[model samples]
Target: MKKSLETQTQLVSLNETLINELSSLKQVIDESNKKMADKMDITANALITSNGSLAESLTKAIANELNSQNRKMFGQMQKIENLTVESMSKLSSRVASDQTLSKVAGNQQVLAKRMDGLATQNQEILKQMEIS
Candidate 1:
């Protein structure tokens, strides 16, 4: 009978130890869950911040590229305009020179015709032996 009482006491002690171990395990699991939650929050915040920075940088780069293209286009347009104006000026001057040349050529033709008539008259006079 005393041995049976000793067995009962041992069983009760084992059960208490098991209960204590389970409570300790529960506390460890709760602490692990809290740490995991904290880590997840930290990671989430970092991602948000990184994304925001990347978006801002992307926007800024695009704006800068557009501005650069606009400036380049304006420069090209100015160059084209200057070239057009220069070509137009040269064309106008060439046209004026051509008109002057045509006027001179017409005068030269009239003079040549008069000289030919004079030569014909001189030849006829020579044939009559008026002037050797």
Candidate 2:
């Protein structure tokens, strides 16, 4: 009966030791998980920072490209405007020349009619004189 009591005491002591070891292991596991969590947070923050910088750079690049295209379009528009003005000037000059030519042609027709009338009057005068 004394041996049985001693056995029970030893079993109780071993159970306490097992409990302490399990507690220690749980603390170690919790510490490891916390460290891992901190590392993941740091990595995520770095990625976010990198992404922000990349977005800014990409936006600047797109804006610059658009600005360059706009400048080119403006230049082309100016050129087209100048060309249109030149074409209009040339057309106006041509129209003035055509009008002057038309005026000269009308004057020539009037002169021809006057010459025909003078010839008819001279023929009539010649006929009268010859008969007399």
Candidate 3:
């Protein structure tokens, strides 16, 4: 019975030592995991910051390009408007000139008829004198 008690005491002491060792190993593992977690968090934050700045730069560049294109489009529209106005003016002048030419043609036809009547009357007068 005395030997049994001593064996039990030794077993208890050994168990205590094993618990202490396991606790030390657990602490080391936890510290290593915490360091890895901290580095990962730092990397993630840096990536986020870089992405945000890149997006801002891209937005500004796109806006400037749109503004430039709009200016060019507006200039093209102005040129088209000027050309339309010029074409309308030219068409109007041609129409007015055509109307004047029509009136002059009518006047020339009436003058020709009057000249034919005068010639016929002069021929009649000459024939009557010759007969007398």
- Estimate every model's Cα lDDT from 0 to 1: 0.96, 0.97, 0.94
As for TM-score, the candidate ahead, 1 or 3, is: 1
List, residue by residue over 11-67, the lDDT tens digit for candidate 1: 999999999999999999999999999999999999999999999999999999999
Judging by lDDT, tell me the better candidate of 1 and 2: 2
Q: Pick the candidate with the highest TM-score.
A: 2
TM-score per candidate: 0.72, 0.74, 0.66
Residue range with the least summed lDDT across 10 consecutive positions in model 1: 123-132
* After superposition, candidate 2 runs with Cα above 4 Å error: 1-7, 117-132
Order the candidate numbers by TM-score, best to worst: 2, 1, 3
Put down candidate 2 lDDT per residue, 99-132, tens digits, no spaces.
9999999999999999999999999999999999
Instruction: Candidate 3: give the clashing pairs.
Output: none
* Candidate 2 lDDT for residue 49: 100
lDDT tens readout by residue for model 3, 38-89: 9999999999999999999999999999999999999999999999999999
